[model samples]
Structure formats: structure tokens, C-alpha cells
Target: MLKSLVVMAVSFLLSTAAVAERLKDISTVAGVRSNQLVGYGLVVGLDGTGDKTTFTSATFRNMLNNFGVAIPPNIDPSSKNIAAVAIHTDLPPFAKPGQVIDVTVSTLGDAKSLRGGSLIMSPLKGADGQIYAVAQGNLVVSGFGVEGADGSRLSLNVPSVGRIPGGATVERTVPNAFAQGDSLVLNLNHPDFTTVRRVSETINSLLGPNMAKAVDATSVRVRAPRDPSQRVSFLSVLENLEVQPAQEVAKVIINSRTGTIIIGQNVRVSPVAITHGGMTVAINENIDVNQPNPLAQGETVITPRTGIEVDEGSGHMFEFAPGASLQEIVESVNQVGAAPGDLMAILEALRQAGALKAELVVI
Candidate 1:
């Protein structure tokens, strides 16, 4: 009877662990991804926002040279309205020749803005220096700037860059192919034993009995059909199969610059007393000019005055009993009138005091 109870308890614990996650969300086939492609190009048709030839003479000269024309020996290229730019885009996986993709154009020279400009025929190359796509389209500037005779102008975030949706045509295809061998590999975005086992079990149940098995926390190997077409169809079905991903253990992330704080839903805080206080000092300077009476031969003198002040407000300490949850922690913090920023500091302090149960990450 005692032995039966022990077996039952162990079985229950194992069953709880097995149901954590299914499969699809945790793993993906290896060697399937997007590729980055970049190139240098020029944008024309700007309303006087193009690069001055003196600053970007090479770009202007090259552009004219592309059209089978040369600058007169004494002519200045800056007089021409043109802009030198760099174009960037990501070639999605399986992109074919003649397909269109959006491109981003950024000024590489001293051009003030790219508004109302048209990008010339630009060949975008990858790291291999091979042209993968040809980009040429009207530029779309999201911001605008205006200046008056008084040299006063208001500008938005950035006017020097723009994008062209479906602006580039793929002139070449990037070779991306997968072949099936004795086994197929599954790569996990985040590696964990609990997740790997669940994925293996789920695949095996769908395909057959134990056809897929975990090689490690990060990789799983599965058997595939010998025919290429069958393997492709099999993978299509495998990718859509749903698997709930395991949640990360408790953690807190704080961005100090933005004063943004995010805590994982599973984070827990232990009970402890918290008290916060801050000091502010201010200094003011005053200057006064003393003038001589109307006709008197007195010289003017300046007087300097300085004032310093400090403020101290009422402060209180609160106690938190043990076994406190996140809700209780928030309530206790609110009761002490702690602002978000102050609460962030207090949370850090609590972590150091061994009262906070999760890892504290500050960015």
C-alpha cells in the first residue's frame, strides 16, 4: 500500500511536467531564414534639397557619366541638382527573380532632404558584390521641412530619408534550398529540455510512434520521406502544428533611460519592509545694478545675491509580511505613495535585500 502511494505521487509530478507545451512554437527547421541585401544609389528630382556638387561632386559626376555625358572641364558639378543615397532592403526567403520588394533610401552626403525625389536605376548588391536586385522608383518622404528668409524653419523627426514601397525588382535569385537526408534537424529559438521533450513527443504522436526525437535542448532530429515532394508537403504540415511554448521563469526588465518597467507575469516578491526617500537641492542667482544719482560723480556697481533652499517631506516605512504575491507588493507600494520611478529603485533595493524572488535586469 505504501509503495502504491509513492508511485502515484511520482506519476502525478511527471504528468504535470509533460503537459507544459505542445510543439510548433518552440522549434523550426534549420537553414530557413531571410537574407540582407544593400546597395549604393542616387536620388534625383529633389526641390533644391539635393546634395551640393561641392559636397557630393563624385555622385553628381558619376550620375552624369552613367548617362554617357561628361562635365565640361571647367563646369561645377554642384550646380546640378542631385542626391547621393544608399539603399537597403531585406530579401525574404524564397524570393524569385522579377519580384518586387520595398527599399529604404538614406542620404549618404550632405543633402538636406529627400522629399519629392526619384531614385535612379540602382543595382543593389549583397556582401558578395553581386547585384541581386535593381531598385528605381519614386521616393516617399514621411517628413517635411520649411525655412523662411529669416532662417527660421520647423522640421519633423527626419526628412533626409525616405522609402519606396515595392520599389525594387529582383533581378537575380538568391539560392536557398534544403535537402532531406537520413534525418531532419529542428532548431529551437530558445533551448530548454522541457520544451524539447514536449516537441519530440508531439511530432512522434502525429507522424508515428517515436519518429521524431530530441538530440538536445536546442535540436530535434526527425525522419523524413525519401521523395522531395513528399518531404516538402510533410514540413508544411509540421510547421503549422501548434505547440504552446513554455514560459520563461520569473524576471523583471527595467529601461532606465525611458523609465520603462516590465515584470514577467510569473514574477514573485517575498515579504519585506520598504522605505524610500529622496533629497533635492536648488540654488538661485540674482544680479542687481546700482546706478549713481543723476549728476553725481559716482561709478556704477553690481551686486550679486545667492540663495539656497532644501526641502524635506513626510516619509513613512511600510512592512510586508512573508508570502506576498505581485498584487500584494503593488498594493503595499501604492500605500506608501511610491511613484513608478521610485518603485523601480525600491524594487532594485529589494532584490539586493533578497526579498524579491526574480532576476532584476536593468537596461
Candidate 2:
């Protein structure tokens, strides 16, 4: 039979003709990226589901003092319908003043929920300690929770966090440094030496000899005109050039939280023997009442008893032929009626034995 193999990252793999993509799709120009902005703010106008912590009261009084309101020093402002929240958003590159951006608000106090809350004016700051945007708007919460007096609570989604669509206004702009150097650098999103070499050769072939050079696995330097107007046109042409990148490394990713295993098509296995078994122990509790002998002047007492049962399964053993493909491995394992839990253990054992020819990543 023919060798069975699959390309890892099939979802991202394109058709043969479509594999040639715009250079911009795989790489970004150096000095062109987004910055993170964060702010601390207060959320108001909630429907009785708000923070009652002492810090919340102090924050309320501080806000009042800033607005020229004087209160008795001992008066603890116990506002029941206001909450403190942390606001955060990404400031896109070349963002100009007056541009709007969406923001996320997360509760910082004992607020029950952030539903139907409006944020107060908060100045968003960048890493350089400069205020770049101002965020203020009504929060949109898609989840809610309800609790009964008996402490029975049902939650649909996260209620302590919310989002505001286009709520922040940019106050400043982050300058771009694209036109400074005679040569521009391209940074690949997925760094590969083969891809870098291909990109360099493609550019040199079209523009001229030595027009591009692979400085590192991730960075490629290309000669270009230094004039601002000409540089823009040069990049426009450079990003449009189609090039094929290298295939990704074969990997098997497992999510322990969800017990999901994803095996890449390129994944292979050497000859290996695997045994899948299960052992279970169950403990049951029972309560019994002991009564004093008739009129013996003794109180009745309750006694507890536990019963434990153990079942050790003799697992099935299977062997994989050398160079077996991922599909075949899964099929063989399934034919033996091995459960997901058992499959996880078998894969790990194969990896430890060096029979698995792929990276095993657990998350």
C-alpha cells in the first residue's frame, strides 16, 4: 500500500494554486503594530446589583471631592448601585484623534453584576504613561445570573464583565516609523527559515539582484526608495507579491480541561504496543440510627457507614505498525473500543517511548 500521511494544520492549508498568498498575509511591516491601553473607571446606574465593599465607598467619596463636594469626614458614602471597573482596549497603529474604539470593562469590587451599567469618564493610558483615549459609555452585558433566597444560583454567562461598542475616543496618535531607513524589514507572523529565503529570492528576482536579504528566520530586509511618497508605493507592490510558506511542524494538541485531542495529519507513529485499561473505586455512605434500650435513659445516636467497591479492568492491548499514519492510529484504537481517557494515556506512553513522531502539546 502507499504511504499514508496528512498535512498538519489542514484548516489553514490552501489549495495548490491558492497557496501563493500576499506577502502581507504572512508578515507585517516592522514598526507597524497596535498598542494596549488601560484605564480605571467607575460604573454607575446599575439596578441594585453593585459593589458594597469599603473600597467602593471610599472611591465614591473621592469622586465627590473632585467635583467640589464636601462631606463630613466620618461619613462613609455607602452607595449601593455603583461599581469600580477596569477598562481596556487596543489602540490601533496610526490611530488619529477623534477615532472611536471598542472597550472591555471588568469589575474590580464586590459587584454582583455589571448589567445595565454606564461607565464614568475615564482616561485610558498607554505604556509610556501618556493618556491616549477617553472611555465612557453604557456597558453591554450578554450574560446574567439569578439567585434564590435559599442560595440556589443559576448563571447564564459571565455577568461581572461587559463590553462597550465604539465607546473610547482617541486623544492622540502613535507615530509610524516606516519611511526612515533605506531598507525596510518584514517580520513574519509564523517564522520559518525556508519561507524567509523564498521571500528574499522572490523580491530579488523581481526588483533586482540583492534587493532582499534574509537577516534572520523572522525578519527580511529589502532595499527600497527612501522618499515618503515613493516608499508607500514600494510597499504597496512588495506586499502584493505572492509566495508560498513552509508547512508547519507536526503536532498533537490536547486540552486537558475538555479532554479533546487533536492530531495533525503529518503525525506518525513507529511500531509500538499500547494497553488501555480502566480501574475504578466507588465509595458509598450510609446513615443508621441507634436507639437506647427501652427506658434505659440513653439518647438515640446516628451512626455513619461507608462501603467501598473496586473494579480493575484488564485493558486491551494493540500494536501500531511502523510509519502508521494518524488516521490509522485513531481507527485502530477505535476498533478496540478504547475510550477517550484511555486514548490520552496511550498517546502519552507512545510519546514517552519515542514512538510518536510529532510534538505533544498539552493545554
Candidate 3:
């Protein structure tokens, strides 16, 4: 009976571990990937926020000349209010011609802002130097900026960068074909040997034995039907096949610049002792006036002196029990009576001292 109890306990633990996370969020099949496309274009209809015609004269003249308007070779076309910009977008898997995709346009010139601007017909080219799409639409700028006299100004978020929703039309198609091949590759977004092997094993188990194999830590190769129509069905079955992916080790990531800290759910700290203390020094200046004989037209003078004071914190150290939960760690640290900034330092020290079990990644 005691042996049976041990077996039941192990079974319960395994069942709990199986439902920790979904496989779809952690792993992906390889052949499916997004392609990057880029192009240069001009933005028009700016209310004086466009590039100055004087500085970028050549760009303005070329754009006008493209529309069959000829400027003399000697003439400088710098005064037209147009901004040159670079457009970028991702071409998803199975993208075809004539489909619309969103594009982002960023000013390549000294344009103050792209608010209330329309992107002209810009041919976005791929790495092959071929026109893959053309982007032309009204830009949707999300940020606001204002400036006034006396150097008064207010701005929220980024003003110069903006995104255009469905602003580009596909003009060409990439040559990559996944449905026509006899084999499919699954690519893991994060390369992990254990996860890859488990995904391959799961796929093979769901399909037929030896149907999927790990090519590397980041890729899995699977055999599929040769016919395009059958391959599509095969992929449909492949994507729906579920696999219990391995769990990521617990870790905590902290960004010092923004004072942001993200703790993984699995993060746990071993019980340890901590103590924090600091001294604060403050100085204040006071002025005094000494006037010689007010009625006798005496010159007035001012004297200044400063008062110095020190404030120190009374600190005590407390030992936490082993296998302390995150709450326990936080409470023990807070008992030191330190500010958040000071606590950040204390946590760093604790992590370095081998007390923190979770990986501490500071950025």
C-alpha cells in the first residue's frame, strides 16, 4: 500500500506538469516564415512638415520629372515640399500578388513630422532589387507634438514614426513554395534541443512512426505527400497535431532604465538573510539682511549661511526559511525599510550572492 501511494503521488505530479503551458505558444513548425520587404518612396500632402525643397532639391525634381514635367538640367528642384521615406513590411507565408499588406514609413530626411501626410506611389523593393509592392495611402500618425514661443513645447510618444494600415499592395510574389514540396520543415522560434526533440517525437507519434525528425535544435524535417493538394492537407494535419513542449527554466528580467521587472511564474527563491541600510545628508541655505542706519541712507548687504544635517536608517537583518516563495522573499526584503531603488540594489546583491535561484537578467 505504501508503494502504491508513491506511484499515485508521482502520477499526480506528472499530470500537473503536463498542463503547465500550451505547445503552440512555445514552438512552431519550420517551413512557415515571414519575408522582409523594403522600398523607398516619397510622402506628399504635408502641411509644411515635408522636407524643405532647398535641402533635398534633387529628390523633388526627380519626382516631378517622373510625372512628365521637365525641369531644366541647371534648375535645382529643392523647394518642393516632399519628404523621402523608406517603407518596410513583412510578407507572410503563402503571400500572393494583389494582396494588401500594412507598411511602415519613416522619414529619411529632416521632416519635422509626418502628421497629416499622404504617401505617394512608392515602389517597395525586395533584396532581389525587384519591385515587390507599391505603398500609397494616407498615413495614420499616432503621436502629437506642439511648440510655441519661449521654448515651450509638449510631445507624447514618438512623433516622426508612423504606421500605415493596409497601405501597400503586393506587386510581385516570392518564389518560395511550401505546399508543393515533398518534405516540410518546422522551425522553432527559440532554439532548444529538448523542445525540438519533443516536438519531433510528438509529431511522429501522432502521424506515423519516424515521420518527423530533428534536423537541428532549431529545425525539424518531416516527410509529406508530393502533390500540392495533398501536401496542403498534410500540413493542415501537421499544424493541428499537439505536442507537450518542454518548460522554460524560471528567470526574472529587469530593465533598470525603465524600472520594469518581470518575474516568471516558476520563479522561487531559496531562504536567505538580507540587511540594507543607508545615510542621507541634506543641506539648506538661509539668507539674512544687514542694513546700516536705514534713515541715514546706508547701503544694504545680504549674508548667507547653510545648515547641514544627516539622517540615518536603523537597519536589521532577518533570516528567511529555505524554499521561500516570492511573497516571502518580498516581505523579508521589505522589512529592511528601504526604498524601491535601494531594494533593487539589495536584490541584485542577493542574486549575486547565490541566494536567488531564478536566473536574474538585468538590462
Can you give the TM-score per candidate against the true fold? 0.82, 0.83, 0.82
Runs of candidate 1 exceeding 4 Å displacement: 1-27, 53-55, 279-311
Write one digit per residue (lDDT tens) for candidate 1, span 175-212.
Answer: 75456476678888898787777777878889898689
Worst 10 residues of 1 by lDDT: 1-10
Candidate 3 whole-model C-alpha lDDT, 0 to 1? 0.75
Candidate 3 TM-score, C-alpha based: 0.82
In candidate 2, what are the lDDT values of residues 1-363, reduced to their tens digit?
011212232333334424777898999999999999999989999988898887778888889999999879887777768998899999998899999999999999888899999999999999999999999999999999888999999988899999999999999999888879799999999999989999999899899998999999999999989898999899999999999887667788877787777777678899988877788999999999999998799999999999999999777888889899766776787767765566678789889999999999999
Stronger candidate by lDDT (2 vs 3): 2
Root-mean-square deviation of Cα positions for candidate 1 versus the true structure, in angstroms: 9.0
Question: What Cα-based lDDT does every candidate model obtain?
Answer: 0.78, 0.87, 0.75
Best by TM-score, which number?
A: 2
User: Which residue runs does candidate 2 get wrong by more than 4 Å?
Assistant: 1-18, 275-317
Instruction: Name model 3 segments beyond 4 Å from true.
Output: 1-23, 53-55, 144-159, 266-271, 288-303
Tens digits of lDDT, candidate 3, 1-363: 323332353355446656633445665645566778898777777777677644356767777888899999886665335687888999877778899999998988888678888888888887778888888999889886887888798888766777899998888878665765668887877788888898888888888888998999888889998888888787777776666666566676777886655555456666777776778899999999988996888899999989999988676788868877655555565556555566568668878888777888888
Clash pairs detected, candidate 1: 23-243, 53-78
